[model samples]
Target chain A: MDDARLAELYERYGFLVHRRCLQLVRRPEDAEDALQETFLRVKRYGPPRDGGATLAWLYTVAARCCFDLMEKRGREPVAEESQLAALEERGDGSTEDADRRALLGAALRTLDGKTRTIGVLHYLDGYTQDEVAAQTGFSRKTVGKKLKTFEDRIRQLFAGRSHEARR
Target chain B: MTAPLPPSPRGPECPPAAVLEALSAGEPTPDATRAHVQACAACGAQLEALTTGRDAFLRARPADRFLRQLERREAAAPSPWRRLFPVLAAVVPVLVLVLVLGPRLTGDGPGVTWKGEAFRVVVSRAGAEAVPLAQDSAVKEGDRLRFAYESPEAGHLLVLELDGRGGATVFHPFEGTASAPLAAGQRDFLPGSVELDDAPGTEWLFAVFSPRPLQAAPLLARLREQAGRAEPTLTCDGCRVSSLRLRKAP
Candidate 1:
């Protein structure tokens, strides 16, 4: 992609990549590395023609890079809750922060590729459930239900955290 | 980021999750989501909290500093080699003359005669060829002499001089490819080469073709006029130096 397009992506969706990676990796610095590496890869190989698919392609690349980093770390293909809580406490980045991220990361790993990918594109990346459906070849109802279920699970995760974190 | 409301037959029920979702990606919330957020203290607090984190991360690396570092990288690249034309013109004639006369290094003895049309060079054995050539080669101190050559027959004889100078001396009679060792200078020759140390000065003479009794008289006269009072210099102008003579025929 040209620098203008790359810069536009940086300005528009840069955070989703960072936050999505933070959800997977749990460390801010490592997540930053994974995101930066992902963008750099996008700069190199790049998405072709379809501007509409650009975000999804970039998201896919970022997702792959984050997974590669997690694999390299040899942790279960997901970030843990307590670690997510620490990142959230360190960040103060809203209630939708760390453990919610960890729970999402863990839920995604448990899902089949099609369902998991749809869930990530819908929730973590903020793509509409329809958009997630388009990217993952899933039906809209399937994406909608998956998202609602994911949201319920996130609520459960936070509720559990409130009890555990209560000293 | 706007919260999508619960499915409403009459209107939308904006959910905090959808609003927070939009906000997470740094986009503005949908109007319905904003109305929902305005009514909900929890959604408002979450917005305020996430925005604070976003703002802190935005300034982590200033654009000015990043651009400055890029400028430094570009500035570090070496300038395209510029061989000043005048020195080049001067070096050309001398190189041609040396190539024409077959460049007599005359050993390391007291006599090192470099014979040419306009001037004759007889060097005193007292100095190193590098020292004196560095002092006299066409380039000024710190400048380099780039030598170009094409070898003909065995034992290549290339004239070493500055660049456009090669282009210049074609006005004179010079020959040989400096691609290999001439024993005269153990170093300095590439597909091209540049003088490492100093400019070779006044001692060099660029030879020209004299056609008094032969056929090229008119050409030499025009060339001599161009040469004027200036010492013989080499040029890359297209001409064969061996065909050009320095001495006028009787």
Candidate 2:
């Protein structure tokens, strides 16, 4: 956690951390704050002891910081219209991707910290269940169950939104 | 039974974004993953996007500038004392006044005895032997420095620096808002070393040791306020402050 190592880590991964923060918070300023906070925590608690991917470890920390900031501010994750439109335009066929992308923030808020992290690693970051298990120190079964919970919650959110639209 | 969840958009053959990001950063990646990324257009495009995004982010917010912003934000964050002020005012007015105003009213209250070399600093320069720094040692910019301390009793410690530019920064447990715990007796070089910044003139390094952890933000503020003095010190009731002065040429 010395200054030299920290500076090196920041140089290497700061952008990835910032991008993760920005993805979650959707505000440049807040992302910057979370990015700093992420590094601060890294300084406080050093890096992962196990020989996992440093970038994966950083992404989890950045996501947690973003979620904490959002909760502290008592604000919903800002879903910009432009971002939604981009997702919509990039959709393969169904609006599933767009809906999943848009509802992820709200759904994530409803989850416990561990489940949320697991969900983000698996769905958002595209980590496989085994990779998520390795990073999280959870068994493959636990990862699968947590992912099921996350998917169920996402479905509930999408269902609620659909009902609202129909109404 | 509930329907199975949709598969990840990355597809079955593609590697995860984390793998791609690691590849983009030039970190070690599996040969299979690297070959897949190289052969697969989608994976290659994703890696390209990651690289492009990283470049854009670094361009927008360089490390030095971002670090400065972080320092400012840390300085500006509200301390625990500030958050408790209203409660202290309502509940214990006399105690609050004594704690708040007593030190300022009295000319620099009781000073702790310098318990026989409780703190130490070691400097390492490229192609040079590592040397332990004494009081008023000559140091140059870019000399990496490490710190150690010897304490009779276990306590919380903060190693703070007042640079030539009157800027205060935490050295040990770098960039934290509070002191880190220290074990009793002699402890050798702390975990990390800090390279001296380009700021020229006299730099003061202080090791503030206390029975309890002290908030670094308030101490940093005090150091900034007293930067004009020959030596800046902290006023903690149960805290001992050891200082090392280093002369830096402009």
Candidate of highest TM-score? 2
Candidate 2 clash figure, as a count: 0
- TM-score attained by model 2: 0.55
What's the DockQ for every one of the candidates? 0.05, 0.21
Candidate 1 local lDDT, residue A5: 61
**Per-residue alpha-carbon lDDT of model 1 for A45-137, expressed as tens digits?**
774446344445556777788777766776543455556455542122344454355556555654567666766655554455566677667
Model 2, span A1-167: residue lDDT tens: 77667778888999878766766776667877899999888877986556777887888788788878888988756556665554412111134465555566667877998898888877667788998999889999999999888888878877777677799
lDDT of 1 by residue, B173-240 (tens): 13331122323222333333332233232223233211111223333333444433333433322222
**Off by more than 4 A, model 2:** A1-4, A43-52, A86-96, A130-142, A159-167, B1-7, B94-250
- In model 2, state the lDDT of residue B54: 80
Q: In CAPRI terms, where does candidate 1 land?
A: incorrect
Ten contiguous residues minimizing lDDT sum, candidate 2 chain B: B107-116
State the lDDT of candidate 2 residue by residue for B1-250, as single tens digits.
3354554567678887667777887889889988898899888887777778788878877877777776776688799999998987788978777666665575366645242487888899999899989888999989999999888899999999998889999997898899999999857778989999999889999899998988999889989998868867666677877888899865
Best by lDDT: 2
